[model samples]
Target: MSEKEEKHVIPYINRELSWVDFNYRVLEESFRKENPIMERMRFLGITASNLDEFFMVRVAGVEDQVDSHYFMRDLSGYTPAELLLTLSQKIHSFIEKQYSCFTRSVLPALKKSGIRFLKADELNESQKKYISEYFDKILFPVLTPLAVDRSRPFPLLANRSLNIAVRLKGEDESYFAVVQVPGILTRFLNIPSEGGNDYILLENVIIYKLGELFELNEIRSACTFRITRSSDLDIDEDSDDLLIEVQKFLKKRKRGKPVRLELSRGHDYETELFLKEMLEIEDHQIYEIPGPLDLTFCSSFASMPKYEQFCYRPLQPVYPPSDFADCDDIFKAIRERDRMVHHPYESFETVIDFVRTAAEDENVLAIKQTLYRVSGHSPIVAALIRAAENGKQVTVLVELKARFDEENNIMWAKKLEEAGCHVIYGLVGLKTHCKILLVVRRDEDGIRRYVHMATGNYNDSTAKVYTDIGIFTCREPYGG
Candidate 1:
């Protein structure tokens, strides 16, 4: 390469690799002695699950490019193929370290705090009996076991479905079977233990009773595995009936090709090979997690009521700027002066109250807002409906492409449309990511506009935990 060419080469870390490093920092927090034991465990779980998605969407996309013989290179001068190999190695090492931290460090600390995660073989007979009964009553009815055979084609494994791979043997020959863990049931089932303790994971409970579901004369081996697919929604902007097109695309998301497979490390070699061939995944794509395939189960650690001491102390959200404390009229507060609201630290109720007051106010002319990821049973949606009912002009831009939240947004859009609000399904090509609430009012001077701009969604439930910033203003340029 020429000297000028070498000089122009900027050394930058690939975004994907940098993201893994960021998650490593989160994993490191789990080892901190200062954090509450449960909180540390929560951090570890979050990091692991975050990596899963990163590989599924980001790594999978690069792999696709390499597969297609595309030669595009990144800023670091690494082609897709080169980067995938590098990433796979880096991720393997990172996951190994994460599991070590969890198994070696966190688990012991948790045990000291009297919070225990009982493995499948660790359960006592009484505990086993309780778990078995719970499974029979609650879980057995929901599971579907699919056997791979000449008569039955391989069943479609939906993205992110946790399943059990079973090796079954009949009188004639041996075969493979799959049991999908039901989505309707909780991933972690709390088993009653003495002295306010809890025990269970749906996987272990299922493993204890696999024979009941299979009905096979003999079972060779079974292991838990999960698949993640490329969930990036791609749409042609020029398409007609955008809503119809989006709905069609949403259906395809579930059946998207498996990009990553996570199997328990102890899975038999034959069964692992079978999964690779069946799923059409290369060996490099399979990750052998040491513990449960999904560490998301660790979120259940938050449920132990007796371990309340192993959590962050709760802090009540403060009202913004004390001036609006008694005033039912939000417009009056904005008219007085500009205000800023910090979230999780400041209340989201003020934003809801702003919309609610406008809906109720006779002088308020219209309200316009953008909806991204709103909390379930959103009071904000209800307020907009109420505003429309009061004959105030209401317009809402609902983003239907938010990951894992598309269906909820679609339902909300239909409800908003039915309520006579002018609902827009966001811009043709771009997602309206801005969180904004605009209110128009008629006062003695003239028509005035008030705007609430937020760094986070107007979701009250999340506002209690997610640190975000928002501003309530009626200043000259911003208000106009």
Candidate 2:
């Protein structure tokens, strides 16, 4: 290649900024007038939630490098610090546009469709009574108010945990206190509306009853805020016990330093300053979003009865091949030909059935599989357990370090162990993300090896949403 041709070569988009641009496209979906109002709102919410994770893990990682005075450049020719600065500005502008779209367009459309989000003051006497009852019965029981003092010390804020900071004042002195929003409870509280409409947002209800939580004569200020910590996993390849090392890292993740602080719109200067000082965050790290702090609640919009007309019509997944439909013997079907299964479009039940059939077959000698992420109630895991119980040599390579799925994977590992399956925690340095299942069966033509390779998890639940591909084959060389 000539020097001019090399110079003209297109550089890959910066992964961080490319992600943000992808989110902007999602946001644009919400602006389509043809889309159902609720669906649009859902898209907007997804965009918000996507950015939250991007900042928490990706941007936080770059920021860490910048903080350590290490200048690392990517294919885009931007250093970590340079990228952080650029991302901060871009995100602020994007969020401003998102808020405007939500408040001006989606909210009005929702109201027109008989769903209303009422302010505390707008609630009628009956509505107030219902909300108050809910507070006393549910919210009040779960809340633990933590006061900031010389003795108490600043409490550790878990990543993405929603918290309300309150300014309480007595006759002589004033102080601050924090109350975490419980994760177990739903974020949206659907209240009875006069017509067909409904009211929601647990935060709005909590803020309405702030005076009840505190014994201050004058409740000076209360603002809802959430902190996202640096949650990128860093593993040492040289560690002797990789599983133990990952567990240690997971524990440390809970107390990771705050990388991004999200505050409600128009947060008081004093409260902002206090948070910045206490959390040791720079000005660029703070983001002020109008409306709710977390947009994951937008998922609830899908449940809105009247708004069903606005969203995409649900479709049932189909089996990829018709031959497997009649022949229940998956091994026999695979032995005949190679089969490719498209997921979200193709039924994952076929995958589950393959495992179930293998577990029950007396001819099957051994089963080996790699698990990245499995469903909470995984049929695949059940099949593995059953195979182990039947005395089949079952070997499972469970990636214990799959992010956010670590705790669930740990639980599954223990369950598999109890069932007598030999479980491996995966390789030390590299994550075993590849999805592979190998089955050895004693057939009429001697022992044969069958394999299943998929682009997605064997998790049945996520198969309904994420698009993925899977292939089942007994072809020579490749299958073995």
The per-residue C-alpha lDDT of model 2 at residue 222 equals 86
User: What does candidate 2's lDDT look like per residue over 421-464, in tens digits?
Assistant: 99998787678899899998888777788999988787899998
Cα RMSD for candidates in order: 2.6, 2.9
lDDT of 2 at 394: 97
How many residue pairs clash per model?
0, 0
Candidate lDDT (C-alpha), each: 0.83, 0.85
User: For residues 298-339, could you state the per-residue lDDT of candidate 1 as single tens digits?
Assistant: 666664576678888876887754646666567777888887
The estimated TM-scores of all candidates read 0.93, 0.93
In candidate 1 the C-alpha lDDT for residue 166 amounts to 92
